[model samples]
Target: MSSTTGSPSPDPLDGPLAAADLDALVDEWGDWAQVADLLDVPRTKVGTLLREHRLAAAVPRPGAGQRVPLAFVQDGEVVKGLPGILTVLHDGGYDDRECIAWLFTDLGLPGRPIDALRENRGSEAKRRAQAMAL
Candidate 1:
């Protein structure tokens, strides 16, 4: 999933993590391990957090197996629907796992944590709502 010749630029998906997409299935099921993989963070980092019991949810099960299978998204679902979270991270001076950690922590909202993943998809809606006041 790293850079490749003629490969799409990083942050290919838009807005938050596109709920329709489950490429991050591991995150949904794998706990920190999958989340780390999706975010490209070192397993050790996330693992350490788990060992220390920092995460709010249950600690991920042992092994790197897919506790939660990942879901994939079509290109349009990401590009057409949202600015893509990867782009936001790129713009936010984030790279690699730290960026992902920041995203997770920020998106780990009180309710509907996944809604943060859809931030980009609804950005236009946000703008429209703001525009409605005018």
Candidate 2:
């Protein structure tokens, strides 16, 4: 459900967003169809986009596909810099689940990375991810 070529299984949660809290996280996310509607693309394109790392799912859905966090979508499009930030984190050796956990965890910024993205602070998040690569 991650944006990687092979959807890696989620890592163990070591932050505020623990794996045990996934049920609550799912409530804040949406399915592929909803993501498609937000992006104004076909459902197939949604899958393509996800596979291409244009966006990412918070986690894998119980059955199939993933539920993308609403924070990643803005005005019916993926937020700017999100893909780049994801790439930075991935390049830093963080898997999809780790990325999710980090975003939900506060990095001493004004808020969590996901909250920063939702508030149009993706650049800050990207900067932090870049620093993480050090």
lDDT of each: 0.36, 0.70
Instruction: List candidate 1 stretches off by more than 4 Å.
Output: 1-26, 29-83, 106-114, 119-121, 124-134
The residue-level lDDT of candidate 1 at 41 comes to: 62
**Residues 24-117, candidate 2, lDDT per residue (tens digit)?**
4433677889888888989898778777677777554467456777677888888777778778877887766556666766666786777788
lDDT of 2: 0.70
How well is each residue in 1-134 modelled by candidate 1, as lDDT tens digits? 66566734223224333222233323554555565676466767655533332222222233444322222122212223222443444345543332232333323243122243354344543233234223
Cα error, candidate 1, residue 99 (Å): 3.1
Best by lDDT: 2
Clash total of candidate 1: 14
Best candidate (score: TM-score): 2
Listed per model in order, the count of residue pairs whose N, CA or C atoms clash below 3 Å is 14, 0
